[model samples]
Target chain A: MRVSLSEFRPPREGAAAPALRELRDEELIERVQQGQRRAFDEIVRRYKGRLNNFILRMVHDPLEAEELTQDTLIRVYVHADKYREIARFSTWVFTIATNLVRNRVRQRKRQPTWLSLNPAPEDDEVPLDPPDPRADPSRQVEREELGRLISHATSRIPEKYRVPFLLREVEQLSYEEIQRVTGLKLGTVRSRINRARARFRRHIKPLLRNEALLAELEQIEARLAAEEGSDSDD
Target chain B: MFCRRARSFISLALDGALPADRTITLTRHLEGCARCREYQTDLQLGRRLLATSAPALADGFEWRLQLRLNRTLQEAARAAASAWDAPPAGAGRWLRGAGLAAVGGLALAAAVGLFLLPGEWSVPAPREPGVPGALVERNAPQEPAPASAPQIAIVEAPATVTSTAGDPTRTSVSGQSRTTWFGREGTGRAVDLRLSGAPDPRGLLERQGWSGGSLEDLRSIATLRDQNRRLRDALAQAQREVILLRAQSDTARGGLAADAGGQREAPQTR
Candidate 1:
């Protein structure tokens, strides 16, 4: 059985029959090339949420994400002839979104008002760990707090690592899909994702210093270890 | 496994990339290691948090997109239609050719008026004093000068440096020299050229095939006249063709209207 990249996505929503939505991405694009507006509408419906979230995480701006998402789709419509079936449609569209966000991020960097809340590593004369969030009585690592921290940390990671990292973890793209979307070597993808994971952990570690989650983590780890031991014994 | 290697494996395991066998070892390793366990927990927690953190798009996203797409497509269609509906190339070319010929004829007329028209040209006497307002009559050929004396042609040139046109003090170089021509504060004198020891003008004009009676010059003028006539004829033909095209266009439009009316009445009768 041949697995396609589209399998990684969730099942389509709405009462639209699987038979109708079942048109292959390449076929839909061909229909669009033949001036079928319905086919292009199907494409926009399918990729809008995924592309928007991917771009949102990359740029950390909602409005820019929406604009870039629309721009990417319009480009697909305008230059539909440029697309080839050599790669999956998801991969090609994600590549376009990545490039658009990359250019926007580069332009933002040139502006003086574009500031990151996180301090740079070079700002430290001596390597001091980030202040523990647990030390403050007012700052509890609640669900919302944790979500905010994760979002902030995700944004704080260098864009190079952040891009591939989001494509892998949040978007749930496979390693190979990430390699295709980012146009990075497989080995580079692995290392950058690993590095991004480490940085993300470091950023949120102080917040996750809660005793309850650690106790839960320990129980889960112990159960997994026992299962592994039983499988080895058998 | 070493803590560092175990951390990497744990990261891959979080992404579901680790092999099953390595997963077991990583589980056992995590069981033994507190630091690696914390690392795995942080990654999982962050991943879970990120899932819920994706921003929801604003309302009416698809509607807005549809609106933009319509406007964009309409613009593209309009541009394409204009390109397709442009006038035919042959008619435009003929029209352009006629306009260029008319411009060329006007330019040729101006050149003839400037260079070949009879003007107040006089040859200065060799002994006349070189003064600003001194006028010399056209030298009579019967009174011949010495062979060694140079023959010079003097033509009057307008002094663009000062007010010469419509000025009451304007000097006419037509054998009438106004002594008070340069009396006004801003009025300036005309320009004069006295080429001494130059070659004879008549001999030079004959050598260059531009003498008054030279056949080559007359033939060139005749050729220009013939070309002007041909261009006028071509212009007339182009105008007639344009009128014909307009008439054909109007006839086609009328036929279209009649056909449309017939179709409308047929549908009503049915």
Candidate 2:
């Protein structure tokens, strides 16, 4: 059966058995060196999604993330000889992605073309429009307030700190690994993560006092619990 | 305690980099201090939320990447195959041909000199009678004989002349006729002499007139000279071949010695 790329989405929870069943990254790399097309395909199958998401978080553009991910894979193929077994394949792959992201950011700074594409302000800004009269007032108020808080908090954090923060808090990479990917010192990586959390907290504090943030949090927890139930059934 | 260093330590503790003992101490301190506790809790909560929200791999990204990688591998394989199949460059082919030609020319010259030259000398038929007879006739006086001279005169006169001289080897005929006979014999002898003459036979050939005898002598000299030159050239080529072969052999031997030494040293290293 042909397994499509879409079918390879990461399981939300860890699957120890599948991880064991898959070939080790180094073994896949060796196969690639020997001109095994399938091996390279397997490698791409293993890393592409994770890498794409990682790049997406950094660039915040799905198209650009996809392009950068493809570029990273191409680099891996071209410079396969340069890979050393000493470093984990994930580290090496992320290093390539990070470099590309950094270059894109630098290029944007110089050219400023990306400024126009800044994820439409409307997409980021919480709608100030009043709730529909027919809608339940409590539900509408909660949704509006939560949306406003998340947008304000996420948008206020500078891109530099936001990435490290997201990566640490959201992506869960260890400080050393983050250091490897970002070419930052361990100290700097931690500081960025800390600063990102502080910024997030400052933005959310005002909205959190309104009680809607707490209600939204409860709703998220309920959704997660439902997801857990379905996962358990599987 | 909440200094810059302490703040940095707090960040490190949040990242799970603090040693176990230090982490415990930091945790205890954070629990008691409201401000620090709030900071630590916020950081942890933010990190957890972000981790949960970080995007999962997009649909079909892995498959597309796989396809690209496969194409790349195939292209590299084809390139390698083509390179392996292509003919070697012109300089390599030319060098190989030149080396063969040089070795062949040397071997040919060596065979000709070693086998043919001595064989020519060992031949008895052409060397004895023709050479002696030609020498004797050349020494005799030159004289023109009548075209109608009888066959008996030639035979009987030599017998009579030998009897008169009292030595069968010594015989005299008419001066003019004898001169003509001697001239022909001398030319014939010269032809034979030129074949195995001195190192430089050209000097001897130059004295002879351009007649059939002289032409024969010149041709024999030319042939011998050519043979000598070929022999010398072949010897030189053989010498060069020997030197090259020796160097190659020595190199091979050296390599073998090195390999043997390496084998001998392996056990010691282990």
Candidate 3:
């Protein structure tokens, strides 16, 4: 079966690698301000997937994520003069993205009910089938259950907690950077992450016990690791 | 430090967010306490699961972003170029200079025309003395001059008398004409003596009794003629001054035009 880009890359191996990559975001932004088209291209290449995924999770629509990503980059170009070194460039960029997402959500709320006939693609539908009993069904079942549980739990999270949770857990932003991006206090960010953790645990604990789900998760992990190996080789 | 405050630190410790020394202490404490230890494991597991479960974005997202940046840069460049190419301040200055020169030229022409022309002077051509005899015969009879022989027979004597009747007193006083010949010596001066026609000189003097009346009339007429002559001379002088002023005005205008032409041509020459 053909794998999607989402399934290709493994989780980041070490914390230090992302930290080093993040140090370049500011340099790229400076170059963009100086009219370096290639620097802007590099920035898009670096953050497009991550920003798209973040927006996709928030909006839950691929087309909307694509459009919002474009809008985010355009906004960065228009407002590049306003970028300051006091905050990390990634935090500033994400702040713009989050604001756009919030506005899109609000606009969607104000639109008439008839116009909203097309719903977002159902993320809850599991792609993998139930494992055979003859096979290592227990682990396969566990991974599938865990995937469904995670999707449901994250989908249910309110925007306020979901945004902080995504930034902290998925984007892996520092607390101070999250505060800058979300315009929330450090205390509030910490509490929201704690609450998101509690909610995530409540949803995932039952699914974590499935033997088949665990096996499927291990298989997914191995595939992800192999993809990462290939990417590093490239 | 306080009873309830330790819970906040416990929460922080679960997130691996406490200070280094505090983290060590918190971890040691958590190892002994099952509840805190469970909380830490739950938090770590939640973080890991959330990280893995979130979807990754589509590929080649950066390329689209770069395209957008390029388009924006182009738009900005176009705007800058247009702003730079707009008409400049020098054009306005040149227009103002041209307008001022035009107004000044018109004002100078009008001033010369309105204030500089001679007043009440009419020009007449010179006439020959012989034309008077022809003119007199066409209009009326001519009076004959006195002759030394006194033997010329004049058949137009009646016509002369009839014509002189229009000046009846002069015709009636032909006997006394020789006495006034000395008084008509000065240019533009006239003397009148009617001694023969008057019946009584004392009665004539009594009838016009104002003292020095004749002398005053002659003096007043001479003064008026002199004033008129002075006025004519002054008017002619003023007209000449006006002509000179007009010439100067024209010359100045030519100079201004030449200067402006030079300025215009300087750039071409360069």
Candidate that scores best on TM-score: 1
TM-score of 2: 0.46
Candidate 1 local lDDT, B50-130, one digit each (tens): 665455566556655644544454455344334322323474445434332432233233333334333421212242344
Model 2, range A1-234, lDDT digits (tens) per residue?
A: 122233333232234344333679887887666655455556766676677656766666667878788989888866776788887777788778778888997897788463454563343222233333544656545544544445446767898887666556545667777788777887788788777767787776664455655566667557657766975575
Winner of 2 and 3 under lDDT: 3
Ranking by TM-score: 1, 3, 2
Q: Is the docking of candidate 1 incorrect, acceptable, medium or high quality?
A: incorrect
After the best TM-score superposition of candidate 1, give how far the Cα of residue A186 lies from its true spot, in angstroms: 1.1
lDDT of each residue in B27-72, candidate 2, tens digit only: 6776677877666666565554443343444444544554454445
Give the per-residue lDDT of model 3 (tens digit) for A1-234. 111223222222232233344548888778666655445556665676678768877887777889898899778766666798888888998899999999999998998645557876355421333333433555445544554567677777888888988887777788898998888999999888777766766667765566775566567667668767975664
Ordered list by lDDT, greatest first: 1, 3, 2
> Fnat of candidate 2, please?
0.24
Interface RMSD, one decimal, each candidate: 24.0, 24.4, 32.1
Worst 10 residues of 1 chain B by lDDT: B176-185
Native contact fraction (fnat) of model 3: 0.29
TM-score, first chain, each model? 0.66, 0.62, 0.73
- Per-chain TM-score of chain B, candidate 2? 0.29
Q: After superposition, how far is residue B143 of candidate 2 from its true place, in Å?
A: 65
